[model samples]
Target: MSPLPLHAVAIGDGLTDPATQVLTKPQQAFAFGLVDEKQLAQAQALAQEAHDLALAQRYADAADKRSAMEDLVPLGARNLPEA
Candidate 1:
């Protein structure tokens, strides 16, 4: 016989309850500095562009969004050891 669906067991355990999935702790942001005003502007422009792109593609699938979101990470957080 085919194995029972694993998700079937989870249904009775309040797995779908919104309260059971409440956040105990949410992430706080990390702080950093940019190299200069030019870099800061570059980062801001990148963010605005990403925001606009997401807005324009608001109906796109989640996988496309996951790909689009890689740019959302600030450059300092990405390439620098610390910033």
Candidate 2:
């Protein structure tokens, strides 16, 4: 099948500690793939790089970065999963 248009796509991936709360998990992944203009492979590579860098830090630091990124997204765009 042909690839979907970038505007038609919504992709997300993240790592979480086993004890992380369920509702918060999606929010963490949201920072990676949402609102990207890059091709999927490039986006995935960047996300992998971010994930690897995050993994090198303490969990709390990574979580803080995710939260900060999410905050930068406008409210309308932040509601993707709800739609």
Candidate 1 structure quality by residue, lDDT tens digits, 1-83: 99876764433433242221211101111234423455444444444444454456542442243333323445444432211
Clashes of 1: 0
Task: Write down the lDDT of every candidate, Cα atoms only.
Answer: 0.35, 0.44
lDDT of 2 by residue, 2-82 (tens): 986676643454233422332342443455455444333343344344455465765565555445444444555544332
Candidate number with greatest TM-score: 1
Report lDDT (Cα) of residue 26, candidate 1: 11
The TM-score values for the models, in the order shown, are 0.34, 0.33
Candidate 2 clash pair list: none
Give residue 39's lDDT in candidate 2 (0 to 100). 34
Instruction: Say which candidate scores most in lDDT.
Output: 2
